[model samples]
Target: MALKLLSALDAAKIQLYHFKAIIIAGMGLFTDAYDLFCIPPIMKLIGRIYYLDHHNSDKCSVMPKETQYKTTPTAVVSTLVSIALLGTAVGQLVFGRLGDRAGRRRVYGLSLGMMVLSSLACGFSICKTRNCVLVSLGFFRFLLGVGIRGDYPLSATIMSEFANKKTRGAFIAAVFSMQGLGILASSIVTMVVCRIFAVSSNEPKSETPDEADLAWRVILMMGAVPAALTYYWRMMMPETARYTALVEQNVVQAAIDMKKVLDVPMSEIAEDSPIRLKPPVLPHPSYPLLSKRFLRRHGVDLFCCAATWFLVDVVFYSSNLLQSQIYHRFIKDNNDVNGYKLAFKVARFQAILAISSTIPGYWVTVYFIDRIGRVKIQMLGFLFMALVYFAIGIPYKYY
Candidate 1:
C-alpha cells in the first residue's frame, strides 16, 4: 500500500492541482508575512492617535497648535514589536506538534482563524484611556502572531507532500517566496492609504490630523481579507496521501486522496494489490523524536538549520519593524518631515528592498535551487548578507 501510493506520488507529472496546492499554501505564508510586519510602517500613526502626548496638551493650544506628537515610550514600543515574535515561537511549538499528531489540514486553519479575528480586533481596539487601548492591541497582536507563524511549517509540509520529487525543492522555495508578495502588498496598501488621506503637516502643532487615525485602522484591518480567503481555500484542500497511507495505515483513503490530486489512472491504482513498500532509510526505526539517538544522528544538521533560520529572522524582522526609526535616525533629513511622509518614505524603502532583494532572491532560489543545490545557495546568501550588514553597520555614525 505504501509503495503503491508513494510510487504514484513520486512518478506523477505536474498538474493543475499542484499549482492549486502552491497557491493555497503560499497565500497562508503571504498573510503571515504581511500581517506580522505591517505594524512598523504605521506604528507612528498609532502613537500619534492612541498615545497622544497629553502631558504636552497645554503646549498644543499655546504653541501654535503645531503637531507635537511625542514618540511612543521605548518600553511600550519594544513590547509591541517583540511580542509578536514571542507569539510566533509559542505558536510554532504548539501547532507543529499538533500537525504531527492530529493531522496537517485539521490544524492548519486554526492559525489563520486566529489571524483574521485578531487583525480585526487590532483595527478596532479603542479605549477611553491610552493604556487600555495599547494593552488591548498588544494582546490581539500576540494572538495574531500565533496565527501567522502557524503557517510556517504547515505550508512547507503541504507543498512537499504534493510536489513531485524531481522539483520538490522549487515548490517549497516557491512557498517561502510568497513572503515577498505579502510584504509588498502591505507596503502598497499603507502607501495608498496614507496618500489618499494625506494631511498637511501642521507647522505650529506636532499632532497628527484626524485623517491618519482612520488610515492606520484601515491598515491593520486589511490583513484579514487575504487571511480569510486563504482559510476558505485551505479548507478545500484534501489531506496529503502520504499521511493517510503511511501514517494512518489507510491505503484506500490514501488512494482516494491521490486520485483527486495526482494525474494517475484509476485502473493503475485500484488493481488487486500484492506490491510491498520499501522502508525509508533511517538509522533506526525505533529512534523517536527527542530521543538521545535521534539527537545524536541529526544534532549538527538540526543546529545549523535552526541557528541560521533564527539569525535570519532576527535580522529580517528587526529591520522591518524598526525601519522607520532607522530612517529617521541616520538618513540625515534636513526638513522636518511629518508622520505621513515618514511612513510613505519607509514604505518606499521596503518596496525597493522587496523588489530588488527579497522578491528576486526568493524566485531565484525557486529557479536554481534544484540545479545548483540548497547548501551552496544558502552559503552564497549568507555571504551577501554578511557583506551588506558590515557595509551598513561599520559606517553607522558617519551616514
Candidate 2:
C-alpha cells in the first residue's frame, strides 16, 4: 500500500505538462474574472449613459435629477452586476455538461469564442438610443455569462487531470490565484479609464456626462482583446492526454500524446508506468459516476468545493459591487473631498482592502491545503463563514 502510494506520488512528480495545462486553463479563468468584475466600476457609468441621465443637459438639477447624475439606483446596479452572474450560471450548466461530452479542448475553445463575441456585444450597448442601449447591455451581459459558465468545471477537471498527482493541490490552487491577477488587471484598467475620463471631463466642451461615459466602453472593449489573444493561444494547443484516455477509450493514442507531452521516446518510457497501451478494465454494473463508491467519496468533495466557491463569490462580489460606496463613506467620514481624486483613491484603497482580505485566506489555504486536504479546509472555511454570518445576523435582529 505504501509502495502504491509512493508510486502515485512519483508519477505525479514525473508529470510536467499538467502544470502547463493549469496555466492554459487559468487563462480562461482570467477571462471569467475580467468579464465578471469589470461590470461594477462601469455600473454607474452605464446608468449615466442610459436611463438615469438620458439627457446631457448642464442645468443644476434637483434631488432626483441630481441622483440621476450622481447615483445609479440600487436595484438597477444590482440587476446589471447580477446579470453577469446569471450568464455565469447558464454558461456553467451548459458548458459543464458539454465539456464532458465534447472534449475539454473543444469546449474550452468554444467558451472563448463566446467570450469574444459577448464582449463585443457589450460595445453594442453603446447605442445612441437609451432604451436600445439598456436592453442591449443586459442581453450582452447575459451572453457574456453564457461563456463564463463553462470555465470552472472544465478548468478544474483539466487542471486536475493534467497535474502531477503530488502537485495537483498546488496546481489547482495556483490556477485559482490567477483570478486575483484578472481582478487586479480589471482595477488597473478602470483606473486608466477613469484618468482618461477625468482628463476629458475637464474639457470646456465636455460639459455632458455622456462624454465621460466613453471610458467604460473603452475598458469593456479592452477586456475583449485579451480573450481574442487567448483564443489564438488555445487554438495552437492539443487536447489533454488523460482526458483522451479516460473519456475517449483510446489508450494507444493517449500514450503517444503522453510521450509527446513528456518529451520522452517510446523506448525510454517506463514499462511499469500506468500510461498503458491497453485500457484499464474500469469496474462494471454500469455508471461509475453514479455508483455508490464514487458518490459517497468523490461526490462529496466536489459538492463541498462547489458550494464553498458559490458562497465566497456571493460575499466577495457583493462587497466589490458596493466598493465605490464603501470608499465614499470612508472619504465622507474622514472629511476628504475630491471627486476625480477620490474616485481614483477609493478604487486604489478598495483594491488594497480586497487584496488584504483575500491574500491571507488564500495563502493559509494554499499552505495547508495539500498537507491537511481540500475537504477539511473547505468545510472549516464554510463553517467559519456561517458562524460569522450567524453572529452578524443575531446582532442585527436584536438591534
Q: List model 2 lDDT by residue over 194-298, tens digit each.
A: 877777675432222556556767778777887777777766766666666667655556556666666555543333445555655555445567678788768
Positional deviation of 33 in candidate 1, in angstroms?
A: 0.8
Give the per-residue Cα lDDT of candidate 2 at 178: 67
Instruction: Give all TM-scores, in the order shown.
Output: 0.90, 0.80
| Residue 52 accuracy (lDDT) in model 2 | 33
lDDT of 1 by residue, 178-260 (tens): 99999999989888887776745443233356667668778999999998999999888788888777666666777788898
lDDT of 1: 0.79
Clashing pairs counted in every model = 9, 5
Pick the lDDT winner: 1
TM-score of 2: 0.80
> Which candidate ranks first by TM-score, i.e. highest?
1
